[model samples]
Target: MTSTPSSTHFLTIKNTFISTKNHIHTSLNTPLHAPNSPIWTASEIAESVHGKLLKWGPPGTICTDTRALQPNTNQWFFAITGQHFDAHDFISPQLYGKGCVGVIGNRVCEGWDNGFVQVEGNGNVNTVDSLINMASYARNKRFNGVLVGVTGSVGKSTTKSMIALALESLGVNVFKSYGNWNNRVGVALSLIGMDRNVDIAVLEMGMSGKGEILELARMVRPEIRVVLNVGASHLENLGSLEEVAMAKSEIFREAKLGDICVFNADDPLVSTLPVPHGVRKVFFGRRMGCDVRLVAAETADGGLGVRVVLEKEKEMVKFVIPSPGLHLALDACAAAAVATLFGLSLAQVGKSFSKFVPVHMRSELQVARNGIKIVNDAYNANPLSTRAAIDLLQSIACDGNRVAILGDMLELGSIEIESHEKILSHCCDSNIDLVGLAGNRFLIAAKNMNLNRVKNIVHANDAKILAQKIVKRLKFNDVVLVKGSRAMQMEKVVDAIKAMSIHIPP
Candidate 1:
């Protein structure tokens, strides 16, 4: 009779053999599947995901998008299926012929050799479940670095990027969730991408309902948890602000003793939450008691100048955030607090702020050919972020007119109308020259605003029309702010304005 390997034996083999191959040397020119990089063997992957491997080949990089398949590289493809699309439909012999290491899915592609791993499913294949299982398995077997989890109604992406950059400045090999991939699948993929070579991994967790963050937390098990704030995001499904706080707090569910939790002290909803027992808590914001406090913020040298007080060091530091907006300055403070926990000094953290880059479409400034300045913040929005963008628009010095092209904030649930109308007050207070409103909710809000408060207010049914109206009215050196929810597609307004402007002489 053959004896099965014990769990201890498996772990020992994984640690001994994998550790020797885990040092990955990545550079600007290095391909993801560069030579000498470590990859999981067929048996390791099969055992991790509990699937049966039929064919074996050299270890390679894992991929989900077939369009990104690269020839001559050892690629393992997963056939992930979604509600409206199934990756299985795209599987072909041609893909397998592209020197693929193997394919993992419920069904095998036609004419493929033994290079396929079959995962059993109930009735039909649940590729998503298989992917998640594989990711969890990989994370368990390979990842031994510190993990940080970031979540909130807004600023999850920005905070995640800032924290990752700050850690990288300290010479730590850091990996972060790409773009705004903060959902469950995105989080899993991000964690799975981490190898033992990484010193730290920053994962952003996003959700549309309760329990989502908890699920992600269980997968990531981050040692450091940063909760930026809890606001009106996903209020439609969650029902109330308190419920939103409850959901955001779930990021701490899997945290244990000695773990660190960062909170936004300026946000009453976030500051009042009780931290898990035995978990160390750090706070950042404009509040007096915060571990990192934003003393003051102002526009300086075409960016944001922020004065911060690091309470733990009992010192004050001033730095220029390479991004616009006071909200971003606060985000820098949050990032500084996280870096400090990782043993970075206040001076080191302050120096790193200058390297911070704003995520695309999130308060990124662009100058048009006509010398008009555009603040593109149309990536995503909720009531809180939209208000912050409006405040940023008013704070900047404009040589000509100040215009705002607004769109509906989606997923506000029953409070959608109330939330849209609430923005009118911000418009009235901003002293903006013209406001172009889009979406049904914003149309209603525009009616509530006093015509005298805003110089001109125009409502459009869609982004294309709103862009047209704003472009016709834009003047030289006018600073236009474009912001809305993801579903609103507000970036169209910025594109439209850019297309209309004459290219300025370089």
Candidate 2:
């Protein structure tokens, strides 16, 4: 008979039970941030991950990017092994020379002998599990803050930022998810270093396929879960819109009886998801009877003036987001719903939103000295967001031509051609004067479209060449909307436009 290893571990850390029988657990019966698990020491971190501490260093922070690694600090590096490249390969002698607290991973790089501590585990361990376990550790340990998980097909980064900024403006100690850091590793990283003084931890959760959000949600178990919308953002990986909806619905996996779940009532897909019994539902959008409903929205004073009414509170909140678009106003509604839950009044929520700025490369409104307006939305794009950007470009009071430098909406899988064609067609239907195109999909779609009715159009293999074309025809005060999928690097066009002198188009 195989004998069970005799191990009984009860870590009473700060009057919080951390581990029992080699397992860590959080009690829903216990209050939020009950201190069931306090901050972990170097030894505790090693023990939890089943890593052997060949050497010990002082407690430190965690870093993933090698370029950001600083010298002589208590920073532990999580060398993530990605698909195409191994981060361990980049861990150089110079990195050790600069000095860090330690490294965590199965790989033993060249600097192993360089006197820094290493938490290396056995069994083909490449640090992802340990990192995830640390994510769990983040969930269990420290501080008093409501962990809010945000997920959707688009606008996740903006929505996550909006919530954080609004709460922070109101003097809440907020810990926001770093820009677009929503993957499994990114999510873990956001939570693992959660400061104890934080009142709200707003984390963005992203996934490309099935089981991704569920896996992440199971680990963090956020108390407030916000599902914005479902669209064709990742149709290539997941197959269809229904499948995409299913993938996003996984964000609610860990939601329990007392948790709060938020959704966009106007979204056809996100509004209909099943909620666990006893969990509170907070809906936001233009739809009637929504907890937070968009009462009226319009361009006001160069920004967005949005009036939102909360049915349950029987109050109206008016706010101004430092950006334009009904979509962004809807995002504000989502943020307002979240703020209301934290005991913030409707008026306070409104005031806090006034400080919200668009994320860089998302919808940054920039004006050149010559009055050339650039809507730098080059971060990432899908069909839903592209339509909004198009509408916004047409609605802007432009004294000059409207040029839309559109890139390929990637990850659409089979519908790549259809999606691209529809966007080009939408541009044609609009008053956009010049429709600049990039990527093979758009090139193909441009060929398929009937050009007799379409406006002036140009094509380029990539962003660099496309910028040349636009600059040649570019005019002062011409409003340009630069947008593309993440892989397209369309910011190059925006940068090129800003750097190069725009020709006085003869």
Candidate 3:
């Protein structure tokens, strides 16, 4: 998928399961670092955090998943703010007689005689800050590794996963984020959740504000930074496109002279950025100027067919991605670009691409019963990404009818309508056979479109209302494209379509 340079961001945390164990401490003692310790050093934890010590002797164990927050079994329950129900409320009641380490909040609580790590702070912000501090401290003590930060408006998560999986396949012990845990708390928590033996650390830095990316970047101090194409996204928060570019470019700003900044050569905004003093930069894309360029690409049923001819090198080899779209091709190029720096051969990198698959809900293809094709690009929405999705939909349209069920793209700020209108214009080009528009603002743009010229255009105020109508309207050989900003919850449309029980592609 195409990523914008604009501000909205997401993080990743791999499934690094921390082995839950019985209680480890009973009373306070000078903290000591252990090679296999999951808890941070006392000094390291104190250095980056500020919180009231509710109770700290020995945290039985750290419980990250809320549903799995079983403190009675021996674990420290940390409640820092109002973001969650007070951990103290459940601590005493749930583990009244249990051997659990309690990490309760500063708020009111009744039961607490011993085993409570209470912290007083400005509710949400301070508690999380300190918790993250603890996570960072744990990471420092835990892993002796290289930190790789991936950011951009799009494809950060997928790129991070591809590299991590490839590294893992090569027998490299790696620690990457799980899901979209790219935020401050997520990053901190992921660090705490990290396994001690990880040889490489991959973190996705998703940002919406000015210093957010910087915060993660500082924590990572990556040996290498990958800036996927920057486009317009989260414009509401970052304010302008330039600011979005600057925000993402902060990676280069923070990178040391010897560190490499991998960029998208096809992206004008990213490619044109004046490289800051000291940091080395390399470009990857379809452009001739790119250090690593896609010489040619073909298409096949199993995957996307590609023939990449690296510039200034004699290597020209064919590769096939498990996923479709030129976007995936670009992602492979970016992965190949970074893999080279990691001492991987071009052939080895090509082999890695051979096993790649689209992260779920990101242009993943599924065929419903009755031969209807569904392209699920529902993970996110942005002006550039939406356009790219539409283009992909258009290219995939064949004997089947092409349909686009869209919702409002969020965080576009003042230009939401114009952005929506631009996509509408693309639909008007006739690649789309039917158009279902949800959201009031989206409806306005649909109404303004040349509806009569298009074969079919329906405006639904909400997804369910529109989904019910489309369920009856969709026919055999129809290709439906469901896309929208995360706020729109457009995945509901994908679900509604799936609920129809059409023959699905395996």
Candidate 4:
């Protein structure tokens, strides 16, 4: 049976991973982050992203869109084409004068010697693979840093930040992913653009369908891989929970014999995946047998205070998560597991946890212009995460009504109706005083279900209309929660409330 490595002592501060093969040796005075010393020559990058050097020039920054191209900046261009749009159309001989060092693509449009790197693969997959390869090359050859990959249906960005904070608290220089930059393009850019002096790089891997995580895993080749949980997220593309679990498990594809795999053992789906023979398994959850277990979570100082148990050290760790909700606390617990693998004591990780803050527009408690508290969890949402946010809103002690402004949870596909119905039902049953809903799915759910059973509900066409409806009912000192899918743009409701008149419109 594979077990969690007791090698924590070996991964402390200043400890980093330095790949020996394909090692890049550059100027001592110039770091890889500095453009003066090219991290990769034209020939080197051609081989890196799996392209041919039809034309060659000095390397610069990487560009996928020409519109965002800065002239006279000496940047490289990637002319990616999709079914509706083609980025290659803007690439002309004049682009070089506009600061393009060269064009990286499969086509040789402006001629062979005009600084074009003939991309080897065809179609969108290959084009993206080429970028992934560039990230892979950078990870394998760049300055020393322990690479950490984070993935799950939710909590990726929050957990990624937590791990970085824990490491940084110990005086470890860390590189981390920002916002929701977990997709292919975002992940590639983050890895390639990292500061070369960091001790650790924490990245998030998000997938929309099958095989996406596997491809990202193949390229990232992280030393420590974190699988947070499997839920109803991306169900429209993946179809079922088992498929989501299977897809998430692909992150272990690059897990070599001794690599560390950290997972949420409390999840029925996540805890049951088949692990490769020799990889070390570290489990974090509220379950008793978990390697990193959550002992308790309670309300404290406008946030959540929790306790974690680290099995190896036989220590009980206590900390405060800067956000409310049990889900966010669990994410921080998972981060503690990852932090310990890097030789941080449970106490050390807990201290850092107390200082961690949620990303903007994500479970943040903000006081509006009229002193109303708004839970701005509008970053993105699914059935599971949306429900959690609802629970959070109900738990807070409110001076006035607890209002919930919710929009559609997108991409649920066939289960869209049922998902919205449950969320609406959850709101009605909770202590929430009023509810304002938007989106076709929620409307359908409200209409399909007996309105006699569901009360305190109002409907709107979209976020804008919902914002108007919510602001009209707004009261002084009321605690409101705004959340929905990314497409729903529920933040508009929060903004609308902030823009309200000094006194209630009544």
Candidate 5:
């Protein structure tokens, strides 16, 4: 797992545990933290959640899964009941033995007497609701730091990371959402873990349909809301680009007076969205009149050199983004715009890009032992992102053939077939020598493609078969790009090719 640059200290609380030997050990210390000391208190939790405490003591850390609990930490396990599995079934003596401080649920566990926080559910009260309520209350009460909420169809995580790094460069203590934890529960938990000492908090808000972003905005109530770009993501649920724009526009709904809302002015759909009154709207992109405009972008040192014009400053500054995608350069520009609002100079923002690390599996470049360059962007995909990846592949200096291994971009609704076919045409237009496709949608798209216009197209039933066929055809110095949606598991192809190269003579 990738971690931010910081010193993380885990507070330990003492708990008594019995060893396998029947002999009574007076003190068996288990790891736990006193929640009320600086973080949270039992009474505060009870008040915030409006729950009856069956057993009350000092509040400990909050947890949702037993597997994630630390050894001696006093953890309050919220037995979140779901359709597939109820956490109530996992509550037992073993959990208590493992230093569980308490359990919050709708029903009482039969054999547990340690500690219980029972939520008032009128027969079907969800513990998750209580969790969210508690988290929102904690965020509202605990911190007064600058809060930034990032949302978009693509690049939310990358842009969030960039903004955090830029703030950190200015010596601001920063807290951001971990990995892709951008959903409702994830945002709640992230807010709950927020430290009071930080100067700013950057949270990524992601959704699959309408109203989800609105709910997240209500929870964070961020003063700085960033909508990166509106794209084809979640079209299956949102129906169309207009609906997607509306869903993303919800980030601005909870913005108060004097809050800053950042948008991408280069995108026709995103630039046209109406901003609510009383909020400052700042746009970032290549277009004129944008608050942060890209003057020029070019390939530099295997990465991207971006010359940006900060309209507020009325000056042009150049920055070298260490990532090799035009999309990444644009994300850097967006991050720079946010950083400038926090009082960082354009020079400071440009210098901060040197420390930026591309998130794993998101256009991360790797060279195998066989000297083949691999672009691993298999984390997730849409038509827009796939085209960006292909553009990155085309820009690289490849000694051998340039190959694109694409898979189905799911959740496109009625346009799934059309989107896949469009991606094939894009590859044909690019400088790619061969295209390897996986998934049923890609197969359908391949059948519709004009073989005369674009030859050397291969289709496989699945990722494993696709990897098998591609590995046999791969040679030294081949530049291969593996990308698809999460369900496609396109990373397996990169793994397969690397494994094959290890056994072959370099």
Candidate 6:
């Protein structure tokens, strides 16, 4: 009988599943330690949940999401009580059977036979806390492979993807935390359901507080920790920009004797970290003293630039990164430096850099038939990345009227207003002729900057209104940059622009 490679190691298994008149097994040959697909014992599930909860609390019923839950569809889910919704509402009747475990819920939920846990107050708070603890627990077990933890005000996801790609290209069975799964809950999910086949797991850890990184660091115990340039993304929650740096640096706190620390040489905060002696330290950027330096950069026909850089062994080699922002260039350098320590050659590393693509809403490029250029960089925003985007927009040349469509950056604790003001000042300094800003903070900052007096500047409190207004104002060959935090949804503006007919430049 053919079995799954190993039921425990399969992220999603295929044809090895077997079904007979009397029995059904997802993997005919493999041992089923948990149970059938979409069903598990209440006790078994509680054991998993216990790993997160740290207490021997009885589990409630197990319910899989209807979308992913199907006959022979190999997955199950546990619902824990939180401050918000109760798991009781979503339970279906088909879950209870001969092999059925218990239902997971806060109180005695109907259509459930297995178990229930009584949460006294604020279920969501407890649920999230328990989940965080469980995530920490699961990651600490059998941590054999090197765990690379990467975080930055920006580029953490992209950098982690590059590390994973470079490693996988070298025949390493790499497991990477998917998308923006950098928070505590996301990290927990990655580790809990990790496939045993993963040779190296690249994790992205993001924090908005003083001790959050330490918590993640303790969980992963990374052998190689990469802290990308820390900037003021969540300044409000994090108190100050310096505090943000400290929080990001906490990734290095749990490094062992032989761990490696990778950092951006150009970012002063990241470069100045007091790394431990036995652990290796590597730096990458355009700075002269850095171990890796971008020797030359020339913007090509498209917004993307052909950049040449010097690595540890390679002196200078030109490569085309499909991005215009210098920040992205620095991210590529950082990824290269990281891959080098992982035993990848310069060619292998450099080749993977080209293969690296930007995630959506982070400086994505689009051109109209009539030659209007738009830089869509509205994924996530902080002051530093905003400035970087502005710099790229300002480089549109002596002829093109560089336009910046900006939105307010969220989660900047108390310094929100001042930070927005600073961004307005940077836009002015960059000589952007036309500026359109959205959200209350940006509107206030724009007014404070006296942008109303500047004939070219326009401020709108809402993003949709601003996008429509700016679409009408854009001219041919005008380079417009659409950027803000994801919450701002500045992509709508890019959409509005595309919706209009292009006006050809004379």
| lDDT head-to-head 3 vs 5, winner | 5
Clashing pairs in 1: 55-114, 236-413, 369-504
Worst 10 residues of 2 by lDDT: 10-19
- What digit string (tens of lDDT, one per residue) describes model 3 on residues 280-351? 676788876566677776555533233344432566657677665666667777777766555556777777
User: Could you give candidate 6's per-residue lDDT for residues 32-145 as a string of tens digits?
Assistant: 231221223334444545522212323222332333333433333445545665555665556443223333334344544434433323344345555554455555653445
Instruction: Tell me how far the alpha carbon of residue 303 in candidate 4 is from the true structure, in angstroms, after superposition.
Output: 5.3
Candidate 2 lDDT by residue in tens digits, 1-506: 11121112101121121111232222211111222223345675676556767666667666766766667655666677766767777676566655455666665565465323344554455677778877786677654456788999888888888777666544545677667879998788767766665656788899989999998898778878999999887888889999998899888765786677888888888888877766667788877778777887777654333333433347886666667665788788888877666556778777777777778888888776555788899999999999999987876777789899999999999998999889988998896899899889998888887652344888898998989887787789788899999899999998888875654544
Best by lDDT: 5
Regions more than 4 Å wrong, model 6: 1-44, 51-72, 80-88, 92-108, 113-125, 142-144, 275-277, 287-289, 313-316, 368-372, 396-401, 475-478, 501-506
- Compose the digit string of candidate 4's lDDT tens values, residues 187-305: 88777766566667788999989999988887777878889999888889989989899999999866876578888888888877777877778888878777777777776654332
CA shift of 267, model 6, Å:
2.9
Better of 2 and 3 by TM-score: 2
lDDT against the true structure, each candidate: 0.76, 0.73, 0.66, 0.76, 0.77, 0.66
Per-residue lDDT of candidate 1, residues 17-88 (tens digit): 234433433321112333333476777777766888777756776777787678777888878888888887
Better of 2 and 5 by lDDT: 5
User: Clashing residue pairs in candidate 2, if any?
Assistant: none
TM per model? 0.89, 0.87, 0.82, 0.86, 0.87, 0.79
Q: Which portions of model 5 miss their true places by more than 4 Å? A: 1-38, 97-99, 303-312, 450-455, 502-506
Which is the leading candidate under TM-score? Answer: 1
lDDT of 1 at 400: 80
Q: Cα miss at 161, model 2 (Å)?
A: 1.5
lDDT of 5 at 288: 71
lDDT-better candidate, 1 vs 2: 1
Give per-residue CA lDDT, model 5, range 195-298, as digits (tens).
Answer: 66655788999999999999999999887889999899899998999999999999887677667788888887787777677567788887777777777777
